[model samples]
Target: MENERAVEPAGIRERLSGNEAVAIAIKQIHPDVFPAFPITPSTEIPQYFSSYVANGEVQTEFVPVESEHSAMSAAVGAQSAGARTMTATSSCGLALMWEELYIAASNRLPITLALVNRALSGPININCDHSDSMGARDAGWIQIYSENNQEAYDNFIQAVRIGEHKDVQLPVMVCQDGFITSHAVENIKLIEDSLVKDFVGEYTPENYLLNAKRPMSTGAYDVTSYYMEHKRQQAQAMKNAKRVALEVAKDFEKISGRSYGLFEEYKLDDADYAIVIINSAAGTAKDAIDKMRAEGKKVGLLKIRLFRPFPAEEIREALKNVKVLAVMDRCEGFNAYGGPLGAEVKGALYSLDNGPKVVNYIYGLGGRDVRVENVEEVFNELEKIDNSGELGEEYRYLSVRD
Candidate 1:
């Protein structure tokens, strides 16, 4: 409590939208470069930052790029030259940067990405969904999802420290739901500028491409002989990221008074039925959980904040006591069995002697409303499975029109 008071001291309180909060964060951090192209739901991030540049509020070198691909390419180049770099995108914009995403990760650049989660195009969506970031799950970036504007701001600030950790030099994506948290105004507490600056510290790459004395090489083509070995190293770094992220979180908690873990467990201790979900939907589920708890339902929720480098062992331990569980996905897995969260959770518990009977529910794609009633229905489904000790169809859709 003393630490929190010392770190925050009732610091700047503001009613700012998620985009504006992120913009303010970037201005405070004042990275060396911000190369970006605009896209909906995410466009305001760069747009707001550009204003900071115009007003000389921050000395960040703003690079207006031609496309999202070019934006990412410029970031890679800037970071390779040993400059702190950041950018923002959503949906198709993130899709456009797909190729470069792997390159940035493989090269081990500590570029912080402000990603607004949005559904990918087909029928064309400009709304919140996990499809964009979920599609890039295996691309080897540290992914953090925020539930609200406060979390969005906090995550972006913490991302810098996480990505630049000495043991884990990897890119980090700070994601928030489009239009939901992104545009919605919320009350947020901000750490003073000097505190954030001191926390993020300096970006001193061990051996950058421009280190004349060290003479290091980046993005060198590797044949089969060394390719697998390099991938192994990247994998190890990702595993290291989990611990590093937690360490950073602990440090952050001292300042913000808001604690975080890999996932947040709500009323899971004595829960017989539970749902594991991500982002804004978790908020809705919590409301449903509360109402159900009032009626003695023993329903609970696991809200995942960190998605990539999936914390299998920890998650298994968290949900082990629950008799039945539903792993909800905002995007379709399209695998015919379960969504990504379900598949990963199932894989994590495969070796457990007694694990919850888990099912998958695809919901809230393309900005579809996931009300408290919808969440209640899922808990009811879990209750049915818990009582019967039998599983029905494994994968289902919620709130979808037939």
Candidate 2:
């Protein structure tokens, strides 16, 4: 659906890293408050944004919080007070904000979290992985992933609109691969500040704790009588977000010329075998898919863009006709099955009468690389499964020194 009411176009093409892109998006939005704490890979986000604050590029009140928990707490309080708010964090930093993450969502505060995906500590490694955001999968935020710097910028911009939508007032997590996209510089087209400001519009909330005209209670403790209903409302709002996300994406495309959806289907129309994955690894899988396609093999790729509220219907429709499907997960779910993504895909396809044989592979933990050859090897496994007509081990590790 094209937004036929065209506004004046404003954008500039420039090279920026993922962190830079997100900071620039925030600058363009000129949010009311930003509670910032420093963490690896993601620290650059606030580091750059702080400069903008110091230079008076934007009016955002930059709160230099001591920890990620405080950062999110500040965001929640500011947002509750009817201020547009945002923050950035990664890895253990995100883990620290776990409790507040639930608070921000449950209270229906439309705060935007820029999460640069990284490995969570146990063996303590600092690099790119999905362990951070994936760990908070059930925390009630609308999660979106980006495959490159440009998508990171675009997702952050759209997140503000999606989370702030009247029907879907939920927090949004815009995730990008840590070092892969966050630290790596790339050419990106940026929409004009006026265009972005017009696109995002003003954050005139309907009801807030600080709205002097009308007083209302928020985040009040609910006993058993109303707790379940509150939970139900939160769940319903999440369901509402799937539709709002697509609508915002469509509107975003009208101005940016960069289209987005629940997921990106690459060469999947006639594919006999396909892999469902997310984030930067999708690029590697796409390259592998091209090679397999050139060899006359019917292989394809489905890159998940909107993860939370899972997009199950779209995924089920996209993969229903394939002969075999492989779901690639970058973080381990440790459910004795596979990663969270693989498990979600299986659930998505479980009701289909003649569902394709689905397999799960957990790969790239602690920043392990998934090269094109590794993706080809996974495709080879898929082809073998399709040909054999007998499902082999359903859960396996890909390129992990196993």
Winning model by lDDT: 2
lDDT of 1 by residue, 1-402 (tens): 455534435668899999999999998899999999999999999999999999988889999989999999999999999999999999999999999999999999999999999999989989988999999999999999999999999999999999998888999999999999999999989988998898899899888878889997788999999999999999999999999889999998877777888999999999999999999888898999999999989988899998887999999899888889899999887788867888898999888888888889999999999999999999998888878888998899999889
Q: Report how far off residue 237 is in candidate 1 (Å).
A: 0.4
Q: What is the lDDT of candidate 2?
A: 0.93
Model 1 regions lying over 4 Å from their true place: 1-8
Q: How well does candidate 1 score on lDDT at residue 219?
A: 86
User: What's the residue-level lDDT of 224 in candidate 2?
Assistant: 100
- TM-score between model 2 and native: 0.97
Q: Model 1 has how many clashing residue pairs?
A: 0
The C-alpha TM-scores of every prediction are 0.97, 0.97
Q: To one decimal, what is the Cα RMSD in angstroms of model 2 from the true structure?
A: 2.4
